[model samples]
Target: MGEVGLRTVRDGQRVLRFQAAVIGAATSQRGSSPRWSELVVYRMVDGHYLISKIGRSTVAHQPTCLRVNHRMVPWSKAAAFGEDSVQRVPCPDCRPELGHGIAPDTMLEVTRYRAILCQTAESAAESLMGDRAALLMPQIVQTVLAQCSESDPNFSRYAEADTALPRAWENTTRTP
Candidate 1:
């Protein structure tokens, strides 16, 4: 794994090992319904908005503030106060307009993370639960993994294929 850089530091702090991120049990109770945020919004695996801008203060961060790791307030929940309130609280860095959809770059990143989660779950289900289960169980897997990401950003770091799932058979993009 080390030969290909499968283990690395994430967030400049947490040591993110692929084995630790993808091999664990799903984070939610089996068979629970998906939350609204999990179903409708695209968010970082950690459920925080990716604040990409380097400067500026005062912006709203929905689903939680990345700077402070504050408790996340879902966009819908905050929008309940009206859009004006939503637009008023700017993040110190990203300057997100609360209730707005994710920034495009962030969407791409979130999509990558979601794809990794799906691929890993499918492989795991096939290995442990059989192919039929793999076919039938993706929604459950999505729900559980989404739940996990909401609470633990580390769970989201399975975003990189080379590091997260290194099997030759699993990597469709690799050449022989």
Candidate 2:
């Protein structure tokens, strides 16, 4: 209905921006930006069930909406909004999709396991690819690591730890 333009939605603390224009629309023929549904979905990059719906011009998620666009951006490039910005409301469409209420300790263990899994994958890729690994390993590792940390709300901390130097024992050997 309204003139199509870019859209933004707040997902938790982050602001996500995506093309309001659909992939194929009459607007494109006119040499203007494409036109997607007035509604757009914004999903959390960490693979969490959290998502948001934004209209032509708004910042907060529309919690009551029963449907949203299927297109998803893996992660958001927009910085988190400041305290002055509107707080995000949880979307009803995605709330039911949250994981079964698991115990906190179990969830912690799961996150740790995922971090280790990422580390192992990196090691394996480096070993198999050898010299050529460096060329693509960063991208591979980062994508895997981001996916693995999907459920982890504290992913930034884990990401920092992942780059830490290997243990002393890993780099040293004892002489007989």
Candidate 3:
């Protein structure tokens, strides 16, 4: 998350900060359930569906990125990543492509997601579990960034250094 050409380097750093700030805000928003999120699904073949993505309403609908247009469906019909061996490519522009959710047709998938929800959020009251739950988020992001760099170093270089990530890390927006 770096320069988007629409803002200065400082503002671009605020981009990711906005996300972390928003999530913290949700945890404290009154009347918000312990674990509630917008589950966007895409219709797959054979009456099956894939959980194309998941996030807060603002994240999906009125977003600065990851935008999509679609009709709604019941969460009961959602399926996890790689579930049922079903693979349907998601839309590229909107990018609602993340395969993971609970489905009514498969109790096993439901149970798996349930367990994941619990381990990550069920014990949010405990605090420490919450700390450990998302330990891999940055690592995963780094992995994705690395893959992108391998594919297109000149473009992906921005994702790695086009921000003042730390006082030490240089914000290299230019390609060599």
Candidate 4:
């Protein structure tokens, strides 16, 4: 462990710097094992601390291990020692427990998917139904337009169609 003595600060606080290097157990079943995280704790504004950050740190999510009496300790056990005993939370960006998988799509992505579905349906109607696809244009438009007060945000992206939307609809709507 190392500490950099007090230095001048913008707010004039004697920021103490300490470092701990921790070797984490390999958490991944497939990817490379968990990498080393070096953590450095900066003093709190009013000396508020959480018993989380301690060792070789990364971002908040990949925070340092907890410590006791200027000695590093495991996070789970350190929490029992209470706030006064703890030092600081991790980077807050580091989320070690969260599994790494395909990031879940946001509502905006869902809306885009809905638009894609609409485009696909339009293509199928024109290709398979031919002249009858004309009759379905108004129905499709109405169905899209009539959705009001609905929880689905899909229409928000769907309705903002390109100017060619109605022209395409008209082309598909004409009777044989």
Candidate 5:
């Protein structure tokens, strides 16, 4: 299980809240899920946010990863205001796992996929920006495929199984 803490301060006043979620080990068929409790806020400086995350399960047991996401509030109503404003900053810790096709690779891919999705969601939140969302999804999917293709020759054969974001979205949205 993992816990999340959110703190917001306006005009020098601070408020904090915590939430928890359960996480499980990675399966051989796909990749490992993130350890929710392992998330730590390394820093939140300027408009950039950084986080340290732990991988679920792999031969390495636990490998720490870093993520950088952008934040900005757009003034234009046509632009998505709350969505992250920048492409995810590159993560250095998972390079070895990315190279070796370990559990880290899967998590990295999923993270990238979500970044793209969140970008789309941000765009969709605006009336005029919604059109941009259609353009972004395919581009993100293609990028994901290209990255996988470059890293693993077997990527295409396993595309439907290993990294189908569409199915992942569907499965995630399905009601239990």
Candidate 6:
């Protein structure tokens, strides 16, 4: 695997704990996102922590940084509470490659993540359990979140709210 990137640590211990939670969630819901299985963690030369998506598929694996505020709340949580928080810029090259004639500029909405998760769960349920009930299970979503959490401590906190999986895949119009 390539050196995904660097992860800076403002508080390593807390970030590690959150990382575990993310991993657990991802493992439990492997079927949620095809990209989930390819996630990895790396510590940067600068001492920052990075969670990278590393796979041969079109899915994007961008690095995000983690930080905490005075109340001991994670940056994501702090954002929810209306506190100023550190931010990570999206990877300039990380864009989804839509296949089968999808327009280049089409943006994937946030809800698509939920739809994809639900579809995957429903397919699994239908094939294995003989019922679609598994589609509605909270455990699956939790697993995805957990995996995301583990891959990047800030993943669940940051991207979960604002980033859309499909948008992340859109082809950038700018020339590098």
Note the clash tally of each candidate: 8, 3, 2, 20, 2, 19
Colliding pairs, model 1: 58-90, 59-89, 59-90, 59-91, 60-89, 60-90, 60-91, 64-72
Candidate 6 Cα lDDT to native: 0.30
**Which is superior by lDDT, 3 or 6?**
6
Q: TM-score-based ranking, best first?
A: 3, 1, 6, 2, 5, 4
Q: How would you encode candidate 3's per-residue C-alpha lDDT over 1-176 as one tens digit per residue? A: 22112211121113211111001111122353222332211112222212211222211111223333333222333332223333333333443433574233222111112111112211221221123232332343333334334433332332443230232223455556
Worst 10 residues of 4 by lDDT: 106-115
In Å, residue 39's CA in model 5 sits off its true spot by 18
Q: Give the lDDT of residue 10 in candidate 1.
A: 32
Model 3: CA > 4 A from native:
1-137, 156-176
Residue range with the least summed lDDT across 10 consecutive positions in model 2: 107-116
Instruction: Give the residue spans of candidate 4 off by over 4 A.
Output: 1-136, 139-141, 160-176
lDDT values of the candidates?
Answer: 0.32, 0.28, 0.25, 0.25, 0.27, 0.30
Alpha carbon RMSD to native, model 6: 20.8
Q: Pick the candidate with the highest TM-score.
A: 3
lDDT of 5 by residue, 57-126 (tens): 1212113333311221112321232212222222345443333323322222221101111122112122
Q: How high a TM-score does candidate 4 get?
A: 0.14
Kindly provide the TM-score of model 6 when superposed on the true structure, using C-alpha atoms: 0.18
- Runs in model 5 with CA error above 4 Å? 1-137, 158-176
39-93: candidate 2 lDDT, tens digit per residue = 1112223222222222221122222333333221111311222212222222434
* TM-score-best of 2 and 3: 3
Q: What is the TM-score of each candidate against the true structure?
A: 0.19, 0.17, 0.20, 0.14, 0.16, 0.18
**lDDT head-to-head 1 vs 5, winner:** 1
- In model 2, pairs of residues that clash are 22-35, 22-36, 46-150
- Per-residue lDDT tens digits of candidate 1, residues 17-134? 4322222223322342212112111123332222111111223443334554433334444443232232244454565553456442220001001212223333432332233323
Candidate 1's TM-score reads: 0.19
lDDT of 1 at 55: 14
Q: Name the regions of candidate 6 deviating beyond 4 angstroms.
A: 1-37, 56-176
Candidate 2 ranges beyond 4 A from true positions: 1-136, 153-170, 173-176
